[model samples]
Target: MAFAENIKKIFTLPDLRNRILITIGILILIRVFAHIPLPGVDLENLKEFFAKNQIFGLLNMFSGGAMQNFSIIMMGVGPYITASIVMTLLPHVIPQLDALSKEGEAGQRKINQYTRFLTVPLAAFQALAMIKLLSAGGISGQQIITGDFTGGNLIIALITITAGTMLLMWLGEIISENGIGNGVSLIITLGIVAGIPSQVRNTLAVITGEGGVDTGQLLSFVFFA
Candidate 1:
């Protein structure tokens, strides 16, 4: 009873409750976006395409299926990651960028602005490449546009996906300002953590179908004992 009361006391703190609830709400929104698709491919075809590309599979795993579906948030933090990678690797090769990097808060803000700019091209190119790759892998023949990969549809898709990622980036920033935790990190972490239970359930169902540990133990006893 005392242990229960202590736990209750912790949750009863108003600030903590609000933070916890805010996190939950943000987490729910991220999950909802991850499942939404960008149109053009079926789930089975997308799965096969992912199976062949380890790099993309890893990306999908991190994004919680957003990449496979070409979801609004499909680019996920990939653009941000690419930007960080550039900053990390360039410090040794680029003297000017490196010098600016050491300017404390001012320097960091500059880098962030650069990253946001860099993210645009990175997101667009990656999205276009992914669309082509998915189609080549037999995932879709849908016009990048509705009727064809015409100039219009291509541009539209480019805009749609790019805006999607930018929106996610903006939302993450908002969360950081008005809610709690680093928005981007929390969003990605939530994506992965949110999938864990479903993964476990799927694995468990397979195990149960095969009679799981009980069957394994019986066979072991028959052969060794």
Candidate 2:
């Protein structure tokens, strides 16, 4: 069969079609979560800062633009990804971890559980760091965090962001179990792809505007490519 016909035949199989649909539905859920903001954020200030900061612009892309909105899952799968990486490397560095890793499914489950525990602290640390960075005069200047940062409110913010990371980790695991492809990879891919329209719009704006073209930015793009 031709490639297109093979694809059609694959989808015609009810099982494969259902799995694909479920995967798509789960991805949609992730996008929805990316828009649900955490409390007390000055979204307009955040957006303005993100527009001006290239580093933040890249962060927003990787985070499904969740960071731009200060969404609950603004940290994206970063903590989980970091934890997984650490665990993967630990097996090579620690003899005990190496031994456990060789014990099959139960051992892998234990490693995963440990990784999950590690993610909590990592998420909390990342959230606090992000909050401080955004509140500092140089990054956002406009006090995107709002209110005081030294009391119960600070704790609340940490907990909220950590919880969001855990929630995303759980959702990704579900996708791995019930859907198609590597769930975490698919999530990140969607986040990056989500910025396409805005990128095209900005490129067009730069091309058509009365202002002279930004040669530096053009050169940077060329070098990056």
Candidate 3:
């Protein structure tokens, strides 16, 4: 079969094989990071809250469940993506950036550097928002962060989350340089894919009435639909 031959040929080519392997290795590393939770999180309460809140459930799916886990990479490539989007739009509005954009690769590199710089504050801000939301504890009145989530712990969390975003950004660049395809997009795609199984299971539970679809909740769902 042509498909089979092509698959075989991919492995037979050393460069292609190495690139594929490198991509896989990086993806595995990202998944591992997704499971490594940050300190001070009450994961049980967090998980329960996510289970009850559809909005955060969707966010968790996009985050590869890192948000639910309160992982270091909980922000994933989100801040970087926001930064890239901002940078892309800025060149259109700012004359200086517009002129720089015409410098070709050099200009693009500068824009990318700016994007990376922007990601830091965005990551920290998002981390703060997440902490605030989780600490609020939803309808269950159960805080996702146990005890006082302030002072040194809060500072450490912000730095750790921001650093995690930077680490992912660096890894994505590495993949782009050494592996195949657009690394950041690949990471985001893989994250979405990784959450599919749990999403399906949750959907099934809802359909089977195991999700306890109350009258108000059902009405809200229908209204949204």
Cα shift from native, residue 29, model 3 (Å)? 0.6
Per-residue lDDT tens digits for candidate 2, residues 69-153, read 8888899899999999999999998999999999999999999999999999999999899888877754545566664666898
lDDT of 2: 0.79
TM-scores of all candidate predictions against the true structure: 0.72, 0.84, 0.89
Model 2: lowest-lDDT 10 consecutive positions: 216-225
Best by lDDT: 3
Query: What lDDT does the true structure give each of the candidates?
Result: 0.68, 0.79, 0.83
Where model 2 places Cα greater than 4 Å from the true spot, the runs are 1-8, 138-142, 147-150, 199-225
Candidate 3: misplaced stretches above 4 Å?
138-142, 209-211, 214-225
User: Which residue pairs show collisions in model 2?
Assistant: none
For this target, which candidate reaches the highest TM-score against the unseen true structure?
3
Clashes of 2: 0
lDDT computed for candidate 3:
0.83
Give the per-residue lDDT of model 1 (tens digit) for 20-117.
Answer: 67767877887788888765546665654553444444556577777766677888877877887887778689888889889989988888888888
What is the Cα root-mean-square deviation between model 2 and the actual structure?
A: 3.1
Off by over 4 Å in 1: 1-7, 47-58, 138-147, 196-225
Candidate 3 local lDDT, 96-199, one digit each (tens): 99999999999989988999999999999999998876787654566667746689888899999999999999999989999996999998988787865555
